[model samples]
Target: MSAPYVLVLYYSRHGATRSMAQQIARGIEQAGIEARVRTVPPVSTQCEATLPAVPNEGDIYCTEADLKDCAGLALGSPTRFGNMASALKHFVDSTSGLWMSGALIGKPASVFSSTSSLHGGQETTLLSMMLPLMHHGMVIAGIPYSETALLNTQTGGTPYGATHVAGSDSNRPLDEHETTLCQAQGRHLGQLALKLQD
Candidate 1:
């Protein structure tokens, strides 16, 4: 069989969520698994149109194949009124085929998010993402209390998933707690995936 990989999928308009994806990928790799980072294009209100096959910059667009083949998943997005952005949601909505086929059943999945404010619905956004993954029969994972960062975070860490307070300017870098929580979530998901594979 091919090597195992954790799919780190996300959508970022202001770069904050993208940065979190990178950190999560780092932790995934640290757990001795490959990290495949991918992103989805934004949806336009204009008449039906599709994005180019390949993105011009940043991570490549995600394919259903990537989702099906991944051993684990780390999904991220920028919060939009306590929910995931439409772009990421659109991508997930297309995965009904995977759900129908039970292709993702039993895989470990985690979530992360970025918000413009400290309480900009980070937890709600994370939970919203988890709902679809759970429907696909994926096992949800989250940062546990053992991850010290969860207890120390004054900004974004939560029992639901990793998160970041990007502030209204979207310029505040992730604080130490946020970084540690992201890494912890990645490591937890990676380790669980490895265990499941065995």
Candidate 2:
């Protein structure tokens, strides 16, 4: 079997969430494990709308195996009315088979999100993402106070998970404190996965 890996899965509409995923993946790699980053296709309202199997740019859609076999997971999405984006929730809702088989039981998982404003439901979105992972028997993790960024960050850091306060136009990139919290949450999740596996 291949070496264990942590899956960094997310849906990014304006790239801020994608940036957070990358930082989290970096921290996962620093924990001596592979980081498999994947993205989900956007949801369509049209009943018959179809999408190409491959995306035009950025990360490809996540596969069942990628999720089922992961040693850990970091799920991210843009905030949609204080919740995760539909694209990510759509992908997550399709994991019934994994849930039935208990493929993710005891695995460590973390959630992250990006919002248009500082108070724009970042924490609620993170909590929303955690629900499905919890149903799959995952051990949810959040950034502890040990990460000083959580205490000092005026913008995005939270005990629930890492977050980015993108400006109203959604053009803001992750600031230093946000980036540090993302890395710290990823590192903690990765380490926890290793410990649980052993």
lDDT of 1: 0.92
In the range 52-148, model 2's lDDT, one tens digit per residue, is 6568998878899999999999999999999999989889998999999999999999999999988999888988889999999999999999898
Candidate 2 local lDDT, residue 100: 98
Clashes per model (N, Cα, C within 3 A): 0, 0
Clashing pairs in 2: none
Reference-based TM-score of each model: 0.96, 0.96
> For each candidate, what is the lDDT?
0.92, 0.91
Reference-based lDDT, residue 82, model 1: 93
Candidate 1 residue 37 C-alpha distance from true site, Å: 0.4
On lDDT, the candidate that comes out on top is 1
